[model samples]
Target: MSLLKGKQLTHYYFNTSNYTKALENISLSVEEGAFISLLGPSGCGKTTLLSILAGIIEPTFGKVTLNEKNVTETQSEMGYMLQQDYLFPWKKIIDNVLIGPKIRKTLDNQTIEKAKQLLKDIGLSSVIDAYPSSLSGGMRQRVALARTLITDPSLLLLDEPFSALDFQTKLKLEDLVSALLKQYHKTSILVTHDIGEAIAMSDQIYVMNANPGRIHQQFEVPIELRQLSPFDARKHAKYQHLFDRIWEELNQLESTSIG
Candidate 1:
């Protein structure tokens, strides 16, 4: 079943001098436990579309539905992880992961214990009580991942969560996140400018065009590639074929924009 659906989503940004159409008639559906990526050039409104789907902002002319109910009518349990960890420097790792439950007033023994297990699963058991400042960039992101998952969200919105890390860290996290999401059976959508990242981590990829951003193409990752971890997927023969195809499409989009 479709866990989340966006119907003809259109969005606009208004300013004192003028208004800009950020997105246009964008429609998409994500199945339960499927992973997808929004791949596009900058200014293509990938983030805008993600925001709308996350219920952080409403579409100017369309509606989003979760589990068949209008998003506005439902309490969205969707988790959002951004490029920056945005962890509270003052809070310990445990406190950082529990922030969501604390804000929702759902914190208790069960939630706290779950948070501990998540930290352990992510290889941060040694630093469960350490502050964010003491952790490395990659470690902080691990905490952020645990924070996002503590609420047990049915869907995860990942906005280039690994972009800020070093290449080695980014690759490791890609494999880690892919495994974790699959283990939990969570539906996820990632927004990234990296074509390789999209192909490596996604079951499906949507390439977007700019100038009133809209979907330009959709490609499904091969079943063999999808079964492997993101790192292993990159080494698959089919990966290069798909990557070149997306590169050509994106190159054409860039040329059109420049012209």
Candidate 2:
């Protein structure tokens, strides 16, 4: 069974004053352990789609299922990483990472050990007691990732998590995230505006258009992570081809209206 499924999903802002058809007839299946990226223009329902899948919001007109069970109202185990790290400055690194487990009431000796292990895996064991401000932008994001992974979520939903980083840092973290996820065999979906980032970080790419926000095309990356970095992928011949195709798809939505 697919790990996550959205069936005939349609979301509309029903208001007599100002109604909005945010999403319509959207459907997709995410298999376990697949690295999928959603590429789209602004207001193309990309973020809305991620929000629904992460259980932050419910679809207005369809069903969302997780592991073959309906999960439209609540999510089971799912980790979400957003554009901002949202780390609390007052909390120490370890404390921040432990927040999820504490809130879930799953914090224990074993879980704490796992958290520490994850920090170590991410090369952050040295700063376990440091505050958020002490960390670099990339380091802060690493802590954010550790905090998310500490919960051992079955799926990861990344909503432009690397968009704010510098060109160099984004490339570095792309590799780091890909490696860590593969090591743990975690399934992930990344929502990004950068087609290069999508091609570099994903096995499958779903290109989206604006307005009603539907998939324009789905393509497979021809290169492997071991063969190219996010930045390096842009230099590959296939990247040129994919970029042109994706740009065309996005450009087609130029005349569409978004609420």
Candidate 3:
């Protein structure tokens, strides 16, 4: 079953000086429990498309749906994680994880315990009471992950959540997130510019084009690669082949755009 669907989405940004059509005729569907990635150049509106699907921005035309209902109507079923951890500096780690439930007035004894377990599951058990400032970059991102999962969102929108961390930390977090999402059977969409990250972490990848950003092509990771963790997937024999293919195409796309 498709957990989330976007149909012919188009979006525009306007100002007193000029208007830009950021996205055009974008249609996508995310199957239940599947992981997908949006890969493209800098100006391709990947974030814009993600925002539209998340209901953070309204499309100029068409619509998005989650579980066959309008996205706006089912907003609570989605969780969005951004490039930054964006945790409250003053709040303790536990309080940060519980913020969502607290904001929605759903926090209770059960919810609190669940948050604690989530933190422990992500290997942050020792710092439950520590402040965000005391944790390393990787650890803080882990806390952010627990926060997103506490509400048990059916679909997760990850917009370059690991981009800011060191390469080693990024790889570790990729493995951690991939395992947790699969364990919970959650559907996810990640927007990233790194082809390797997309191939390592996604079941399917949509390579996009700029100038009225749209999907230029799609690639499916082989079953052998999909079954492995992101780190191991990068070591597979077929990984380099696919990476070269995507690299060439992206270069061609860039040259075309520049011309």
Candidate 4:
């Protein structure tokens, strides 16, 4: 069943003298516990669409529903992860993960224990008392992921959370994230410009077009590819074919824009 659905989503921006349409008739549905990716070039409204789904912004001409309820009314069940880890430099790793529950006034003894266990699960138990500056880029992102999971969100919105890491680190985190999402049974939507990342991680991919961004096509990753780790998935023969197909579609969109 669809855990989240957007119906004919359209969004616009208005200035004093001009109005711009950021998204046009974009529609998508994410199945429960499934991983989906929005793949597009910059300015394709991938992030915009994600923000709408998160209830950070309202669409001009559509509605977003999470489990048949409007997202705007049930925002607390969603978690958003961004490209930057955004951990405070002065805060200890454990403290950083506690920020959410603390802000919500729900950081009881049980919640604190759960946060510590999350750190342990993400391989950051030893660094619980260490500040963000003491950790490597990959470790910090892991802490960030722990923070996101601390809330027990049903819907996770990932906005290129691994983009800033090194390629090897990115691969490792991709494996970690995919595993954790499946383990937790969380429905996720990722926005990325990386083709291989999308193919390696997503169960489903929605290719988007720019200039009033809209869905161009949707592809389901082969079941065999989904069985392999993200790094190994790259070496699969079918991987290249899917990559080339998406590359061609994106190139065509670019050419049309230029012309």
Write the residue-wise lDDT of candidate 2 on 1-259 in tens digits. Answer: 6899988878877776887777888889999988899998778899998998887887888888888777654454889998989999999999999999999888899998998999999999999999999889999999999998999888999999999899898888988998889888899999999988888878889988766878777988775542565657767788788778777766766654422
Q: Which of candidates 2 and 4 is the stronger one according to TM-score?
A: 4
Candidate number with the higher TM-score (3 or 4): 3
Error of 4 at 136 (Å): 1.6
Clashing residue pairs found in predicted model 3: none
Model 4: per-residue lDDT, tens digit, 1-259?
A: 8899999999998999999899999888998988899999999999999999999999999999999999999877898899999998888889899988887788999998999899998888999999999899999999999999998999999999999999999999999998899889899999999999999998999999987999999998998888888888999998999999999999998998899
Which segments of candidate 4 are over 4 A away from where they belong? Answer: none
Which residue window of length 10 is worst by lDDT in model 3?
71-80
- State the displacement of the C-alpha of residue 46, model 4, in Å, after optimal TM-score superposition: 0.9
lDDT per residue, candidate 1, 237-257, as tens digits?
999999999999999989988
lDDT of 4: 0.93
